[model samples]
Target: MQTSSQLKRLGLFDARVPRYTSYPTAPHFKPGIGAELLPDWIRAIPENEAVSLYVHIPFCRRLCWFCACRTQGTATAEPVAAYLDSLKQELATIKGLLAPGIKIEHLHWGGGTPTLLQPDMITDLTHSILNAVPLADAAQFSVEIDPSEIDEARLDALAAAGMNRASIGVQDFDPMIQEVIGRPQSYEITKQAVDGLRARGINSLNMDILYGLPHQNTARIIDSVEKLISLGPDRVALFGYAHVPWVARRQTLIPTEALPSAEERLGLYYTARDLFLAAGYDEIGIDHFALPSDGLAKAHKAGTMKRNFQGYTEDVSKVMIGVGASSIARYPQGYAQNEPATSKYQAAARDGRLAGAKGHVFTDEDIARGRVIEELLCYFRVDFSKLADELSRPIEYFFTMVDGLELAMPGTTDLSGTVLSIRPEARPVARMIARHFDDYEMNESGHSQAV
Candidate 1:
């Protein structure tokens, strides 16, 4: 029922908005907050508190046309090996500032293709990290897997290093679409990867699929989702493809004429959403799905799910430390990111310093507004009164934009008493509504489409 008319009325074509994965999104980060702040943020963590670690492996064998991530391609191991050594240096620097006996509750390895690491490299990297900040007994380690780049040895190594959760990227199963996007992975290849990970005793698995591809239609999306379901992944992420060629240069290779219209994209999403719901997958936030037994689903029901640079996560650690090139870390004080380029990151690490390049320092108001935005993103509703009590501010202080949003998009938002909720029909544009409260100036032109 999300037709073109409905889309235009809702500004589905409105210039994109920040995904609100982090308050004062990365685009708003400034150079004034840089490397110097890193050690202090790390040292400020309360002693013995569990923290989350995100290590970025920014090397890939092939550059997919649709990826917007910060990654570089390498033909040989020289560059990847060099990057890992730099990472080791960065880890050591962080280790020096960390409180004695500090433990990690969550550890994540994100692409470009973490499996690109050789088995021995994985073991060495694991040891270096564990030696630095050791994992808590029940800490969870997760990695993003590329079906084409991973195999038995890598899986065995990851298993040995304590990777309990694996997120596999599928994008789509249509060979034509895969060809156009420059990422071709057959169903058999994906199954083998899953089989390999499962055989290694990795119990949690997440598979990613995309809608709004060049030629994706209801049939194509349904077929892809069905294939994904057959894999029996515990969690599935159905993402709307954002064609931001201006930001993601590789996306320029995808012909604009081949992209689905906003309305068609909506249709593809709803088609897949229906199938996932029918398969007993509970919808988690806008783009993720999880089985009833999945922790994500449980977190949402318990009103504790949170948004991060990695999209929605059940990991609620107040401090998340990001290592390696281009990774972002979240601190109670603010956010810090390492250098985006491999060479620069290596230089800083080799010099025995944090590779932080840019960051955002939160103001009291930024933090309050961030709380409201986060609650709405996770629960689709916010209790203004509760937020006020938590922040010790007036109710109006927390919702300065609700009235304006209600006026601008009538019937799209509800403000009765102290509870703010997007109407049921307006759930898709919740992120757009959430943006109204962002006091930080943003140029929406640079963001991705809301749908």
Candidate 2:
């Protein structure tokens, strides 16, 4: 077995790296590619294409010290109500641009906390979105909800709005960890929230857990995993907290010295994985777990699983339509993001324009590399021979990238084969391995933690 010191030398517990959520992560998004060219781009979306939808609500009741998501805390509902108005206007603008009766295969509402919307706002927003881009018969609708933010009124609104799945935020139940992170929802409160959502017939649930936070350890993770199992969520995402204090200002409040070393972080990951597997959960990818029956696990078994900005998902729509502030939409042609600032996004939409800030237009090379990287990330292996045949390039030509990487990590060349793969035990280092296929090495600073 490799010692912790040895793994540290191998970059096991390095500072943050991109989650590989995308090949060219969001930080690579460049400005100057504004809404000037959106009309033609939106118009270019192929007719009859079934697309996915993502709506971002940039407000939270309270800010967590470790959170890196784009969100603001408010003392009153006035700002939230105003933001909803902007969302409605943005929807109207997008509706006019979209081809009518387009099939929406998947719709997701992600942070700052979609549950923070007033009951009436939830109803109106979902109604308006469905009216604009009708959901397909098989469309999957999901939303991220903060338990404290959920009430009978909001729960009813969510169901009425056609939300069939819910992802609850439960970073850690221990009071010490909660205090350190500045997110203080109790265990009972989370349990009640899950029970309440299930009682109302919304049984498809996901819970979020974290490792590598200040004061987290193997014992803490083991205890938390047991508690999570008792909660019986259909899926669990063991996210490694990414602390970029410079970028996410709230994170500065956390004391840097209290954080775990790289070796400890890797150990935490192994411990968590062992605990979940022993509990009968299937490891879906780098950080996601699900019961064997879950669609995600099933997708993984069938080789149809896909990775997106929201992490691993079963929704494989070719097009993803993002609405609301800081949301990103992915199309066959390229990726686009709304303005990050709330005021700027609202203004762009109120002015009847798509709020595209900066995004990459995919080239054939990007698509090819994206596929290879995604496959390697998801499965921990890639068939280079098959990829070469698909790209009409000799397999040896692709190995040149491997040769360049070999000088940095010689073990990789020996382990990788016609089917490039790392050892099963080296899954956490998967992102570091995938970087070999990245076309651009200059954009590495934006990546998050490597746990």
Candidate 3:
């Protein structure tokens, strides 16, 4: 364990860095490419291969102060119905352009709260997406559930759509933290939500919780983790609370002074990590924990696990079509993001065009570097020779990049037989090290703390 002084020296508290969710991160995206590049990338999907789908639902009943996601609170279902229609239109447009015989191997419904949709709405949306791109026989379907918003009808609709896995949000069960964060949910309700999903035959579950919230001491987080463990979730995502008030205006409501210090934040993380590890959970990457029998664990063991907008994921499809407001789609050639506003996305979808407003076109160098960065962040080490061979670049090319690598995290990298890895104790600085391969300029204000 590092002391406060040691952490300070390493710039853990003061440094700002991208999460490397996408190499070139989202901030570097610009206009003009959406019209020119997105279609080319979509049309270029490899023949007959299954792809992944991500549908974003941006409506929520409540706005949690700590959340920085693109979402809006709605009082009724009128807008949701309109959004669903728009989503169907968007899928139809994509279907007309996409190559034939491609199927969806993984489908995810992320939200504001996917369960906010009424039963009929859920049924129609699922049916529409399937009509456009059918699910593969072994497709994995997952949705994010909100305990307060879910009920029998909503769950029934999801089950009918063949949702085999569900990821529930429980961002600290301590009443004080919940009150401060403006997302008050009782443990009983969450358990009932889990029970309901299980009753519907949802085989896998993932619970998301946060550390570094207001008034979150070690004991409070420990209690939350204990309760979470009792529910038998196959996976758990313990995320550090990113206080980006500049981006999400609602975060200004949170009392900044009440948050834990950097040292305390690390303590909170270690506390939860130790508890989860003792309970036989294998730590996957930096922030996720999974049981030994979970698919995430299997992926990690096989070195196929990947990081994306949703955090550590096992989805391996070469193409990911994100179809919703503010959704970012990933193609081998580049990244394209849908319009962020609900009305804009709806309008674009209605017009039989993608909701793309901004994007980045990947160059050959960008693609090569993206691969190395992804491998480094996912595994804490990268087999440089393997990536170099895969990208058809010379091995010495990475040697020239090592100077920038050290600048990101001094004294943390080592080279041994083409394996480039961060020192074990410096794992928290992996994000910094990954930036070494980023060809884009750093936008300091567009990121969060290094830890």
Kindly give the stretch of ten consecutive residues in candidate 3 with the minimal lDDT sum. Answer: 442-451
Q: Which stretches of candidate 2 lie over 4 Å from their true place?
A: 389-394, 412-417, 442-451
lDDT of each: 0.87, 0.81, 0.86
Q: Candidate 3's residue-wise lDDT over 1-451, tens digit each? A: 4465665566554425677789788999998777567777888897688999999999999998999999999999999999999999999988888888999999999988899999999999999999989999979999999999999988888999899999999999988889999999999999999999999889699999998888899899999999999999999998888888988999999999999988898889889999999999998887899999999999999999988888888988888999999999998878999999999999888988888999888888788778888888789888878987888889888766665555555577888888888887778767766766676743453222242
What are the runs in model 3 whose C-alpha is more than 4 Å off? 9-15, 442-451
Clashing pairs in 1: none
Please write out the lDDT profile of model 2 over residues 1-451, one tens digit for every residue.
4566756665656545567777677777778564766666667777777889898998998988899888999878899888888888888887788775577889899889888888999998888888778888967899998988889999999988888899988888878989999999888889988988888898999999988889988888888878988999889998877778888998989998989888788778788888889889999878899999999999999988999998999988888888888888887777788899999998888888888898877887787778778887788777879878888878886665555454454454344477777666556666776766676653354222221
After best superposition, candidate 2 residue 384: deviation in angstroms? 2.0
Rank the models by TM-score, top first: 1, 3, 2
- Worst lDDT 10-window in candidate 2: 442-451
Better of 2 and 3 by lDDT: 3
lDDT of 3 at 306: 88
Any idea what lDDT model 3 has?
Answer: 0.86
